[model samples]
Target: MSELLSIAQLSVSFGPVKAVRAIDLQIRRGEAVGIIGESGSGKSVTWLGALALLPGATISGSVMLNGQQILGASAKSLPGIRGKRIAMIVQDAQSALNPVLTVGRQVIEALQLHRGMDLWAAQAEARRLFDLVRIPSAGRRLASYPHELSGGQNQRVMIAMALAGRPDLLIADEPTTALDVTVQAQILDLLRDVQRETEMALVLISHDLGVIAEVCSRAYVMYAGRIVETGPVDQLFAAPRHPYTRSLLEALASLDGPLRRPNSILDGTAGAMVQQQGCAFASRCPNRAGVCSHLEPELSAGPDGWRVACLRADVAGPLEIVA
Candidate 1:
């Protein structure tokens, strides 16, 4: 699997506040990679910088896609890559879709723009896309507005529009967040089947661990503005090295676990404060040591391509170190 996208030391800033700091990620062709973190962890910000969607935003570092430099490209050239080669499905379908436009018209517009199909041909392609997304009454639904459809149907329309461009990479931001459980499973299965057929790389961004585990081959856990842990989805979920990662899994596990308190809230304020010397997670970490307050730990490779940014990755069992 050749590398399709490589992001190294990427940083994004808004005014004096730094949202993402030196994040590194790599995605191979046809691979499914996930970025999981709590809200405001900078997972979405990093990808936004990569896509060049943030206006008045300053970005530094390298973003190489298929060996082509993308960090400093012109805005005019960005659309050529945005919808045509690298598509994104935002979290809110209602906000992303035009309310006035019919579902089929929206899909047809995109197809005509990128795939270069005429009006009649584009409509045919649109109908096929509707079927591909498993939407019933494909012909009748084409004339219906976005508001006329259910949440799941709107999401399917978003997926169909994204696929219209035939992108090499698809960035899905919380793709199933707004759907019901049954609908979520169906959407995930749809994505799985589509990926199998198209062989396109996927970048799934979400705060849901279960969602990541279900679809992604690999996962990266973000804290504050940096990657704190990364590994194969199953292995990382089984034995996470970072305390933050462990806490996330504990929060998601069955209610029988001792860590499954309904009101357990991991303190995240410390992550917002910059630590020039110590680990960023030290204040909230359950395994913090004296050295953790004064020394930052670099990400070190562990077994099976796993990387953890903790001073004591060798430790096992529940942590006692805390603020």
Candidate 2:
């Protein structure tokens, strides 16, 4: 299958800090890929750079959508392709949506700009989208401002706007973060349904591995600004090749499991603090070797579509593949 979106050797730098470094990722037509990482790990920055919204950020390498380069496209020319071909649902809906404007108007404006629908037509399409995303009383709600809607409702409106342009690729950065567990599941289901109906590729960036496991067919784990492990979601979850990936799963487990031991807190803390060196997880990695502190490892192919960027992958045990 041909890729709908391809990002190769892409890097985003903020003067002295490298927020993302030489990342390579792809999303095939109608496929869902997840990017999971801890806070400040460049999960959102990677896509922000792709969307050309990273202000004062220096970007290098290529971002191609449908065989066209968007990295260097002029802003004037980019809008013609941006929302129509690619759209993004930002993490914070309250800040993303205009507080002053009615949710209906905001969503219709997106349709008007890209799909070239007139006022009445755009409003009709916007109401249709509201129904599609399961927001009740669509007609009545159309007159409501952003402040009037609940957090989950605002999120639905945001998703509706993102879909208004009928984009070929959807870049969602923690789209369900503000929601409760029940609402979160519903939002994921809604996104999945929309993707299938539209035959659009999805790039889901989240800090929650469980969310990624539920929605993404393929997954990439990022650390300090680099992709540490990548593979099909089930295989990586069953047997994470990178130490950071392992720690994330373990941390997730700790959240659900009993915390009888003191090590539980310690282990969670290990996954949080930054370790800037050869290996970002070297300070806390159980299997760290002498060379791990001096040499940063490159991603190497492993079994079953698995790729790990670690010097100690050989000793990390045979990663069990989920059939």
lDDT for every model? 0.87, 0.84
For residues 1-323, write the lDDT of model 1, one tens digit per residue: 99999999999988767788888889999999999998889988998898888999889999998999988898778777889889999999988899988989999999998999999999999999999999999999999999999999999999999999999999999989878999999999998889888999999999998889889999999988889999999988887889889878766646343444344467657476243668888888878889998887888988778999999777746523222
lDDT of 2 at 205: 92
> What is the clash tally of candidate 2?
0
Q: Which stretches of candidate 1 lie over 4 Å from their true place?
A: 255-264, 268-270, 273-276, 318-323
Candidate 2 RMSD computed on C-alpha atoms after optimal superposition onto the true structure: 3.5
Model 1 TM-score (2 dp) = 0.93
TM-score each candidate.
0.93, 0.92
| Candidate number of the best TM-score | 1
| Pairs of residues clashing in candidate 1 | 286-321
Please report how far candidate 2 places residue 37 from its true position, in Å: 0.4
